[model samples]
Target: MSGLLALLDDVAAIAKVAAASVDDVAGMAAKAGTKAAGVVIDDAAVTPKYVHGFEGKRELPIIWKITKGSLFNKLVVLLPAAMLMNAFAPWLITPLLMLGGAYLSFEGAEKIFHRLFPHADHEVEEDMDVGDPVHLEEARVRGAIKTDFILSAEIMTITLAAIPEGAFWMEAVTLALVAVAITAAVYGSVALIVKMDDIGLFMAATARTGFGRSLGTGLVKGMPKLMVFLSTVGTAAMLWVGGSIIIHGLDVLGWPVLYDTIHRWAEAVAHGVSEGLAGLAAWATSALSYGIFGLAFGMILIPLVTRVIGPVWSVLTGGSKPAAH
Candidate 1:
């Protein structure tokens, strides 16, 4: 009887520890996901554009394919690579993060640069004239997946950096959860965004009530504006997030001047507000500074990337570079 009781108690203790570990994984995953929000938003915002010219029926299938590709990128490729980094060269994380941040800044700045000096994309014109829908779809999917791999690398790294030190298995589980959760959130939102017009058209044509038809019309009209809003927001977010990541990485690497300056400024702004709003004030101030820094850094990168890096990349790949994201 005593031996049985002891065995049961040991099993119960093990169960309790397992439950606590699960809770920890969930909490860490949520925090890590929050840190990667900018990338997540950009991913969702960018994906809809890939599906733009495809027929309505094919939209979901393409999204599904991309979603699968995204998951593969995150789980099979990025996850293991991140784990290896964590295991062997943990110090590399900060530099890698800064590199990713710089990429984001460059991307955001390039968008602004293009807006200022818009160039005709002959390649885009040629792409549209592809005779077979299937071939076009394949090319778009491959392009989007390649883009997703870059973004996913950033997201996974951000998540890995955000997670507190824990057992290897714990880190692995947390990262895996982050991967699955983020992939679902991004692609699911893309799916909805792309299909919304079709849904609106259906309702506009066949809704049983006048109000329903009006609602559908409004949705159809509103979607274009929504896409514009999403794009603008996504750009701003990328700049802010990228800039902040670089700033944070610098701080980690012992260059505290920029980080401290931003912190002091944020605090000074926060001090004027009520206690409850102070955090919000501080955050906004920091975000604003980061965004400005991102914009400046990105602008500097634009000419170099287009003039130098693009040619080098084209040479290395033996193909012309795709348009900048």
Candidate 2:
């Protein structure tokens, strides 16, 4: 009887430990997810444009396809690569992250350039030419997945860095959790944002009550403005996050002038504010500084990318125009 009791106690203790590990993984994952919020926001903001102009029936399916691709990107591709980096070339992480940050800055800046100059989008024009809906959907999904891969790389690296030192299994578990949760959150939000117009129309037509109909109408009208707002926010986020990464990377690489300068300026600004508002002021100042740097860097890369890289990429790809970021 005592032997059985001892065995049962051992089993119970093992279960307790397992439960505690689960909690730890969850907690760490949440913290890491927050650390990657900038990329997450950009991911969410950027995804909806892929579904734009698609029929209502196809929106969710396209989102589902992209979500699956994003999961594959994170789990099969980036997660393993990140683990390898952690194991063998942890030092490479910051430089690679800065490269990704530069890419983000370039993309965000390109959008602004297009807005200002109003160039024709060849990719969109090609999509319009594809008569088959299936083909068009496939193309868009592929493009979105490609975009997701880069953003996912940023997110995974950031998350990996955020996790506290632990067992290999624990780090793996934390990263996996971050991957699944962030993918679900990003694509889930995209799905809703894309389909919101349809939902609003349905509600406006089906609702019997006058107030319900008005609310539904409001939703339908509001969606366009909301999309614009999300796009603007996403661009700002990309610039801010990208710039912040470069600054942090510079500091890590022993070039701390820009980072320290920004810090000092932020501190000075904070000191001038009321205690309750000081933190907010400091953060805003830092973000603004980062954003300024990001924009400048992005502007410098734009001409080189379009004039040199784009043409080279086109030739290598057998004359296919490069996809717009």
Specify the highest-lDDT model's number. Answer: 1
Residues forming the 10-long window of minimal summed lDDT in candidate 1: 121-130
Candidate 2 has what TM-score? 0.94
lDDT per residue as tens, model 2, 1-325: 9999999999999999999999999999999998788788878887887877778888899999999999999999999889988999999988988998898888888878888999887766776564678888888899889878888888999899889888999999899999999999999999888878878898899999998899889999999899788888888888998899999999999999999999999999999999999999999999999988998899999999889998899899998655555
Off by over 4 Å in 2: 128-130
Evaluated at residue 233, the lDDT of candidate 1 is 88
Off by over 4 Å in 1: 128-130
| Inter-residue clash pairs, candidate 1 | none
Taking every candidate in turn, the Cα RMSD to the unseen true structure, in Å, is: 1.3, 1.8
For all predicted structures, in order, the TM-scores are: 0.97, 0.94
Candidate 1 TM-score over all chains jointly: 0.97
